[model samples]
Target: MASFLDIIKRHLALSIWAFSIIAGILLSQTSIDFRAGVSRLAMNSLYLPFTSFSRTYHLLRDRRVENLRLKEELTTSKLRVEALKEAQRENERLRRLIGFSEKIEYSNLLAEVIGRGTPRMPGSLVVGAGSDRGVIVGLPVIDENGLVGKVIAVNDRSCVIQPLNDPNFKISAIDARSRINGIVSSNSRGKIIMENVPADADIRRGDAVLSSGLGGLFPEGLLIGRVGRVSVPQSGLFMTVEIDPAALLDRLEEVFILFVGIAGEGESGVEPPEAQ
Candidate 1:
């Protein structure tokens, strides 16, 4: 019985193949419209899904690339903004210095501080201006707030300034409030110590000290420092006063060299000498 069924199945498959072949031959003899319609249907069914998948993948990849590019641009923009803000702050500080310098009416030659002296000679600094810019020895150097130092040596394009903390640098100063006079000099402990103040002087802490113009080096009334502490030692006849300099020596970057004009009647307020 199984052998009879197997034979029937094989005959059925052969009959189907013979019938399809006959159908194809008949179709080939027909018009071109039928072939065109079959080809179009096959293309739409087989190629459409593959083409759509490829286009979608490329679109997603392009969007990811665009997002990464935008993020990088934003980071660069933020860094540029920070740099610009720092520059603006620096410019404002310089402008404030310039305005303060002009208000003092002191003839000023601006210069940048290039280097600091060695630790053994910590009371001196090197500046970028020198004799070529009218910088001379004994000229007072100051910053926006007050006196910084004085030029002790001058070269072609640079000068050395001896700060107020130098042992040899002394200035005649008067109390801003009480008008008490004293001599300010540097102590061995790297401090400005005021001496020669009378025992009965009314000098107090926090009093501002200004140049008295007794020493021909510094002009009159230039700010020096404020008195920090005052003490009357048991062995000393004078009051020992400590001063805190107005200029921030550690942070110095720029300074103004004061230039005293020649004797004249107009701007400088001095009359010229008569012909000899």
Candidate 2:
């Protein structure tokens, strides 16, 4: 039951054999070297086609291997580029942090933000410095931008900071333009707002809000945020004002622990910061 293709293959093989023998005989008539003439004929008619096929296959395989190697090298280069970019960005951040620390008059301890708040201390962050580094509760924490929070709890290795966004965190803020007074606190939803503003207060949107140094907790003139919105209460003596925090609290990486005697600094052996 040979198919058409099988029958053709058999005939083709026989024709090849006949052609090789005839070509050898004709070449052998004129050529003085009989073995060399037959060998040349067999090489041209039989071995050359197979050799050409093998060479093409090897070339294609080598090209594929080279392409894979190039792809691997390209991927490695991309990863290295990304790592370098990250390093450059980190370097810039540290430079800015150092510059801010130098400009401030207070003696500050540099601290790294290690972790976010836990369940026991919502809306807070853990700093790498603790009592061992002269960090104590009530020390104000700040970043390159401005005031961040105050240290609330400390252990041997770390301390927790109650960020401005915390529900219980509050500071006396004032309008830098007009010296109008108000209290800055975060709402239950973590939105920062200025409370207890007089109804006819000169405070307005775009005013710079700063710590007034009234509560004896935070130092004066530290930036709190810019006033965003101002509203009047229907039946109250004060206006409702919202202020944006100066520091990017959610992305905090490092901060300075201001060593001013805020509160509860006794028994900690920390030196008082010089007045500005």
Measured by lDDT, the strongest candidate is 2
Give one digit per residue, the lDDT tens place, for model 1 in 1-276. 998678768798887787799998999988899889887888788777877887899998999999999999999999999999999987898898788778867667778999899465666899998777777677788998798988888898899999988888888888989998889989988899888998778988999999887755677788899999889877767888999999888899899887754223123522212310
RMSD of each: 10.6, 9.0
The residue-by-residue lDDT of candidate 2 on 183-242, one tens digit each, is: 899987778999988998998789999999886788888999999988987888988899
On the 0 to 100 scale, the lDDT of residue 138 in model 1 is: 73
Query: Runs in model 2 with CA error above 4 Å?
Result: 1-46, 264-276
Please report the TM-score between candidate 2 and the true structure: 0.77
C-alpha-based local distance difference test score of model 1: 0.82
TM-scores for all predictions: 0.69, 0.77
Clashing residue pairs found in predicted model 1: 264-270
Instruction: Give the whole-model CA lDDT for all candidates, comma-separated.
Output: 0.82, 0.86
Top model by TM-score, which number?
A: 2
